[model samples]
Target: MRLNPLGDFIDDDTFALLQQHRLFDAKSVRDFQIRKTYREMRKKMTASDALDKLQELHPYLQYDTIRKIVYMSKAS
Candidate 1:
């Protein structure tokens, strides 16, 4: 059940220091990617279809998370 075990994608020294001090949540990167994927899939398919596709791509993601991403506000 490990996520982002390699640390945040940003390798810069300042970002690394922030991560070391627990000033940020690296998991947000995964959230952002999942949200981005859902948005892209929504463009070519229905909400349910998009959810299914995202599940197929990232089976490790919880079902509720996928559902939330698919149904979240686009303006956010």
Candidate 2:
């Protein structure tokens, strides 16, 4: 069986919001270019240049958020 990616962190309100948006119980976020883009960013960019490059690669993706999610999930 599949569980939520955020699992217990997903409270009733967030679940309801997802359901209301016709999205429910998803386990993974799709279409992120983290590995590919971050690698390239690492190649030519320093910290100051990262955000601009990342935005070019993915406008909607927030690096810190994804990092936190993956980091927390994997740490457990």
Candidate 3:
């Protein structure tokens, strides 16, 4: 019932509703998590360090790719 397993960005009921309507975008959710993680990491380190750690966690993503994702505007 929980579409957002990474965090509670939406309530379970809302998530379930979105799932039922097939309105959930897993990629968007993932990107949101990535941004959230980067923000949290930034609190403890420099921007470059945060991006470095993010890249380490997601080795499949290039440093520039992670940088783009982390710095991307929410309106996108």
Instruction: Give the winner by TM-score.
Output: 3
Q: Global lDDT of each model? A: 0.72, 0.53, 0.81
Tens digits of per-residue lDDT, candidate 1, 23-54, equal 87767656677787777877899988888888
Worst 10 residues of 1 by lDDT: 1-10
lDDT of 2 by residue, 1-76 (tens): 2233344477666766786797843334432234434556667877447655655655675777545432343333
lDDT of 3 by residue, 12-72 (tens): 7777788789897877777778898898988899999999899889899889988888888
How much is the lDDT of residue 11 in candidate 2? 65
Model 1: residues >4 Å from true position, as ranges?
Answer: 1-23, 72-76
User: What TM-score against the true fold does each predicted structure earn?
Assistant: 0.58, 0.36, 0.74
Better of 2 and 3 by TM-score: 3
Window of ten residues with lowest summed lDDT in model 3: 1-10
- Whichever of 1 and 2 has more TM-score, that candidate is 1
Top candidate, metric lDDT: 3
Q: Number of clashes in model 1?
A: 0
